[model samples]
Target: MFRLKTMIGLFAGALMLTAGISQASATELRIASGFGDNHSATRALREVFARKVEELTDGRYTVSVFPNSELGQATEMVNQAQSGINFGVYVSSAFYNSQVPELGVTNLPFVFPDRETAFKVFDGPFGDKFKPLFEKSGLVVLGYMELGFRNVTNSVRKIAEPADLKGLKIRLQNNPVHIATFRQLGANPVSIDGSEMFAALSQGVVDAQENPYSVINAFRLYDAGQKYMSDTGHFFDVIVFAGSKSMLDAMSAEDRQAILNAGRLATEAQRKFAKEDEAADLKSILSHGVTFTRLTPEEREDFRKATLPVYDLVRERLGAGLVDEFLADVDAAK
Candidate 1:
């Protein structure tokens, strides 16, 4: 009994010592984002994180955000973070799918039922599953923010029915799932980097594209040679902030807390801004002379049916069990 009491006291002392040391060692951290400086995600994170991180660290540490390609492209940012050149990135899971294909299961077409359901799953089991994958790749997933449900936008015509997308060359992310979806819909899906999208659409390399309201507005897709938008919310996209596992490991506890605190606060702020952006997307775009096509129930069904192969191919690539786990989350959330 005496030795056990002494050991407990010693463990308590060690914990206190570690806490004190953590409090003193951290200073500041840099965060990288792909969203433009004025974008909702970037602006909200930079503004909210700076204040929240300092407070969480008791001003022992701080966060500085670099938005747009200020630090670099999303893929480049992830590579940089993984290599421990810098810290995290506000990137898409589709971007991470190049390194971790199973993670892309979240981005499958018509998978998520709504935004609320999306937040729950990504913040719950599904998000947890990707953490180790990110860590194995030398990256650490902090958490997720929002990009919201995506709608198809085109210059050629409004897409009220699946037939409308036929023959339209659309810009797609470099992923098999997205490629399969567009191809099944009878459109030629052209894989293009996010950075190249504007120019590609402008030069007519692709006649249409799809993204969340925030993204379309941030890059001025409406003015960038796009004429019509479709309210076909086919998929949900989320921006993930993943840090360098090596860099995080090197951080003192206070600094680590600072990064996570900032991330949580940023998620809230980004979500609020994203909600507003989505609410106002159609009205705002119409003011710029853009047209929106709202699909009827039957038309939407037609759109959904066209992408059946997306499910088959994605499940095959992800394997039965992983795909089942993903669909379970999707169903639970739905």
Candidate 2:
């Protein structure tokens, strides 16, 4: 009986040791985004990125995603990721412009005439230039996802030409290039946080706003009294997937690779989803009795010409030489 009891004690100790080892091998990571949970980018992060990370890491790592600003607003979340408070962030590239001013080149009006050209530039050398800048800021650029082309929406009337936008109060992101573009187009660009955009529009704080179809649909901005939408395609926005450099550096090589691989897969999935859903989102928006304006080539050209000075503003902020290189690269990609 004494021998049997000793054997049982040994067995229990071994089992406890194995359980502890298993627990220690598993890691949990947190990813944050300011987009709504239903947004395609958030969905891609949760469904594809997070899942792929777990699978690629053989269940050794798990990711928890906090969407809809549960972690904080876009800029705050960026700070958290920089400080390693969060493992990663998926937010607008515009949000990173403050940290890497050269990144604002992507936000230049009408730089990308279509999604194909935008993807080529971003996935090519032009996009590669910003990786080191992000690294200098203690962040890793995992991948760039599509936020699609930004369009103008207003409660007052259809913006068929640049002159139509004159004197209208428009809510815009806190992006200098965006603000300058609208200002040059003769609209009163009011910088508003994304969280406050709906209220500002609904309560008449702003008469107009611009965003991609995905954001418009996800936020249900149509319900906020926006009665008109035009395909301005002023800016083709990109959502960046960035990881905390310190956190990633601390991770094992295999684990870091797993995260990067997951980022690539998620980015591809998101771009596809956003492109496919654009038409559906537009249809849904118009179903709410919103008038839609499809600008003719001449009309688009007029708006584009009016916003051309925005390029000069960009060159001033980010040197004429670099801007020239970027524009040349854009042309080559096209």
Candidate 3:
């Protein structure tokens, strides 16, 4: 009995010591994203944000990065953050549109003419105006990272013109604008979650899909039997880093500032990484035997024109007032 009691006492003491240390030292936070660890977004979170947070906080806080939907899908991760179960999650702007509505303004087809224009809008006054939309949805926007311009990948046919998309079934991000846009372009658009995209393409459940080159390579859509890719540059996307307001409010002011700084630095790094990896990813995808097709400026304008009707639906869904305000921002960016 004495030996058992001594062991129990020591174990209890150790537990108490651990609890005390945990209380006094750094707070640990889990950050999650739907993309793979090899992805630039995840790499930024792991290397830039996570490291910078620790450095900025002077070891007062540490972050654990979970990639490839290890924690959950994007929607589930957003719920986790909103409920304060996790510190942060990377979410798509289109996903936010499903909740906030007005956020879909960014999803308008061909709104951003190029990468430079996108950066100006998202990092400048446009980003500032849009960031507050998350607060109403139980999230606080940390910063934005590029997902790059989306292009078409197909096992069926090469898309050189809007007419070429006529009979193909294309998988799109779960955004109404994307679906409507493709539908108007005469292709059947199927809204599928990112996790299920590969199998859908592999089994021919969908004849085609559109995404950035980074996504095409990261997800290995080529390995899934995708034979052709088009540089349509139809839509440019940015991933939003969002946090739980309650969780952030629980932090010390200094710690909160550290997180904000870390997020801003990570955004810059993530954008740079995404842009830098584009040409290489395109080459990597092509080396796998997929035919690469680049749309001419006239061909791209054809697509732009075909999708113009999409803006009316967007304005109706997101409200004309919000759409006008965002268009002004888009114009200002140019």
The residue ranges of model 3 lying beyond 4 angstroms of the native Cα positions read 1-24
Per-residue lDDT of model 1, residues 1-334, tens digit only: 9999999999999999987787667565677876788777777767887788777767776667887667777678878888877767777777887667787778788777688988888888778988898788998777688877888888887778888889999998776777788888899989887888999999989899999877888788987889999888898888887877887787788778777777787888888888877767666777888887887878877877788778878778888788888788867876
Question: For model 3, how does the per-residue alpha-carbon lDDT over 76-142 read when each residue is reduced to its tens digit?
Answer: 8888888889988886777776456666778888888988888787778767876676776778888
Encode model 2's per-residue lDDT on 1-334: one tens digit a residue: 9999999999999999997887688887898987888788888888999899989988888888998889877898888999999889888888887678888888889888899998998999888989999999989998899988999999998889999999999999888899999999999999887878899999999999999988888889999999999999999999988999998999899989999999999999999888888999998898888899999999999988888888888888889998899889889988
| lDDT agreement of model 3 with the native | 0.86
Ranking by lDDT: 2, 3, 1
Q: Give the C-alpha miss distance for residue 207 in model 3, angstroms.
A: 0.9
Candidate 1 stretches with Cα past 4 Å from truth are 1-28
Off by over 4 Å in 2: 1-25
**lDDT of every predicted structure (CA atoms):** 0.81, 0.90, 0.86
Which residue pairs clash within candidate 2?
Answer: none
Q: Is candidate 1 or candidate 3 better by TM-score?
A: 3
lDDT of 3 at 79: 85
* Worst-scoring 10-residue span by lDDT in model 1: 22-31
* Estimated TM-score for each candidate: 0.88, 0.93, 0.91
Instruction: Report RMSD (Å) for each prediction in the order shown.
Output: 9.1, 2.9, 4.8
